[model samples]
Target: MKRFVLLVVVAGLAGGGYYAYRNQRAGTQQAQASAVSGPRAVPVEVASVETMTVNEEVEALGTLAADESVIIASEIAGRVVALGFKEGERVKAGQDLVKLDTAILDAELKQALADLGLARDTNERLRALVQRGSGTQVALDESTARLASSEARVQLAKAKLAQSTIVAPFSGVVGLRSVGIGDYVSVGKPLIVLTSIDPIKVDFRVPEIYLSRVKVGQPVQVRVDAVPDRTFTGQIFAIDPVVDVNGRAIRLRANVPNGDLALKPGLFARLSITVDQRENAMVIPEMAVVPDGVGKMIYVAENGKARRVAVELGKRLPGKVEVVGGLKPGMQIITAGQMRLRDGSTISVKEKPVQTSQL
Candidate 1:
């Protein structure tokens, strides 16, 4: 009887200990489940959408080129006897740039002149003899032919002599010199480069879809990498009628007045052309937009929860973007910490939301 009582007491103690352990484990698991179900709110910066006038613009890359450019070259081969103009100097049209050796040409011209004089004297004597009945008519005609032939030779010599001097074809700045005085050069050899930089041109291409949007006299804004702070404006002076077959793009050209000569040839340019405009368009900061696959999306705050909204985008401006659809005016959108957010996720505004009017 005493042993049975001892076994019962031990069994009662073991059952009580097992029940307590199970209860403790169940309580711990319940606490962990509660913690997981309640998520911490993500902090973010937000901006409100507002109605404003936004420009519909198209952008393209371009290159700046001189209004007129040419490579100065020699027309006739000879020794460079004299350099009339200094390199990198502004020259006027018809100004002498280089003078080739003209000794041989000058002698030839003088000899031709002497021959012409002798022919004229002979022709005069023959006419006098015919008048005096001392020369035949055929002889007089022959002398006249000889006089004409000599005159032709003189003209040819003068033309060859003029070729010895190379003159500037237009008014512009000259480039580096390839030869000095007394340097022998061949015909067609480059002597210098001339470029007219004022009223420079920018060449760019736009998609064929925008062919109708681009036309002559349309305003364009240009910015070059070399001159980042300055914005140059010009009008579309030319547009190619044919679309490029390989790229399906239309070539465009604009002329910008470079009166200060700050822009140069071969500089890369950023071009923007206003194609259309809309009044009272919804706009927000560009950071508020999150690109979705083949589309765009944004996170709007509603009742302390994020609402993923799909938006159709339009003309993009500096620091702001036009919202064409899916977002309304006066809507608050989360701009920062969007990576940690999902639909219906809790959010806390970190800073005062930026007003779209201030954008």
Candidate 2:
């Protein structure tokens, strides 16, 4: 009777365990089915497609330069006796900047003048004697030649005296002076640097494909790293007819007004040349563009789902990009949270679709 009771208890325990395990399995399957049938919507931020005029721009890097730059140098060797202007002072054209010692030059000029006077007196006296038949013709000719020679010497001396004074060639501000008073400087030695700052220049290059687009008088917008908060405007003043063999680009020059003298030479600058303009162009936020294989794409919210679209791109603005095809105005493009989405995925807008500005 004890063996019979033990066998019955073991069979009841096995049956109860199997029934509980089966119920748990069925519950798990039902939960999985529910999960598969209903999925959560992806939360995203969106922007509306816009229509506006867009400029086709060619971007390039260049350096700010002076409108006219020159290093003032000595034309003749001399000892600096006086500095007429202070360093970093604005000077007018032909303003005296430096004065060399003129003691020796003065003495030489005086001697030449005395010689010329004496030669003229002698020549006149000789001519009078020849008219009276007292002086030979050869004597008169020799005296006339001496007079000519003496006059030339006087003119030469005058030129040398003028060299003692060094003046500014143009209106500009003078840079640091390398030679001070009492310093001996040789010909061709640098004295100071003068640069015209009212109207500055910038030299840059662009690809040859834009040769037709870039022309004289085309407007340009320039920005420099040194002057981060400021933007300078200019226009194309010149262009090189020849293309660079190595870069396959054409060099260009633009003229920018700097009446305040804020812009400086040699500062690195970035510029955009407006080559073409499109009226009523379709544009979208640049952040909305997504890489789709070798092309580009964007996600648009439509009918409570995400619609993946491939786009043909055009000009790129500051914060926006031009859409050439595959998109239209009034579409809500997902600008944020697009990485977690797929085609036809359910989407819940995190906020109202924001309108983009013309950038």
Candidate 3:
């Protein structure tokens, strides 16, 4: 009985030792898991806040127009005897474009001159007789009236003769002719279209909210799908004083040089106007900005930790933004891997430091 009792006590002690060993091992494993699951540094890409020239620009759509455009028309009715300019040819101001049959007009002018000469001779004879007191004042007055009437006829006849020739009012390129030689044209007949296109005009509109910021002489950059690879530069020349009631926008016009005539009238254009510019402005990549409530925030790396800072943004460029406030030059701002970051969270940069120029 004593031997059996000692064995039972020894088994109890062994069971207690086993339970203690299992508890110790569990506690060690839990501690090791806690150590392994501790918070780790987040990997991110960072870029330095830089200072450079930045432009505050406004974008708008526009249509190109010729500097001057008009439709050539005849003022008198006659048969076209000659065409001075070929289709699509450039002509100078005062260059003749068409000549009408002037035979009838020339004959009328000759008759008017003959009558004028006869009236003048009679008026001289009447004046000499009146001075000698041999002619009545009434007779002299009648001759004087005839002479004035004849002179007026001659002036009218000369004007009609001159109108038989159609001339270019301004230097421009002519479109297809509406009437060919030997085609009879009437008064106010449409002949052709003339366009002056060397320095083209661009018509665009912007929201009225930008009216205060825009001004004459502001630089504008123009692009068109037709000329995809080239950009045209121009200056603002006109602005409408009244805002458009239907669209709540203001109209503006710019003049751009097209020396090579590559830009055509009526082409759709995209324009960017640089209303303002800042030199040595603080700039950073747009990816660094984070929306926080109604304001904006950015994660800045300082001393191996991230600091969420509220920033005031200025102008925005392609993949870049102007930091008007809340940042200084040479400060590193998080560009990527910001989703897992919190204020005061540790960070490990995954890439080399980025610069604004590199973006």
lDDT of each: 0.90, 0.92, 0.94
Give per-residue CA lDDT, model 3, range 1-359, as digits (tens): 99999999999999999999999999999999989987688999998998999888899999999999999899889999999998988899999999999999999999999999999999999999999999999998999999999999999999999999989999888998889999999999999999998899999999999988999999999999999999999999999999999999999999999878899999999999998889999989999999888899999999889999999999887899998999989999999999889999989998774566753
What lDDT tens digits, residue by residue, belong to model 1 across residues 1-359? 99999999999999999999999999999899989889889998888897888877898999999999999888778899888787777788899988999888899999999999999999999999999999999999999999999999999999988989988888778888878988998989998898887789999999999987787998999999889899999889999888999999999999999988889899999999988878999988999888788699999999999999999988777899888999888999898999888999999989775568753
Q: Higher TM-score: candidate 1 or 2? A: 2
Candidate 3 contains a number of clashing pairs equal to 0
Off by over 4 Å in 3: 1-45, 336-338, 346-359
lDDT leader: 3
Q: List the residue pairs that clash in candidate 1.
A: none
Clashing pairs in 2: none
Report the lDDT tens digits of candidate 2 across residue range 190-225: 999999987899999999999888889999999998
Residue 286, candidate 1: Cα error in Å is 8.8
Rank list by lDDT: 3, 2, 1
Top-TM-score structure, candidate number: 3
Query: What is the Cα root-mean-square deviation between model 1 and the actual structure?
Result: 8.1
Question: Sorted on TM-score, highest at the top, how do the candidates line up?
Answer: 3, 2, 1
Better of 2 and 3 by lDDT: 3
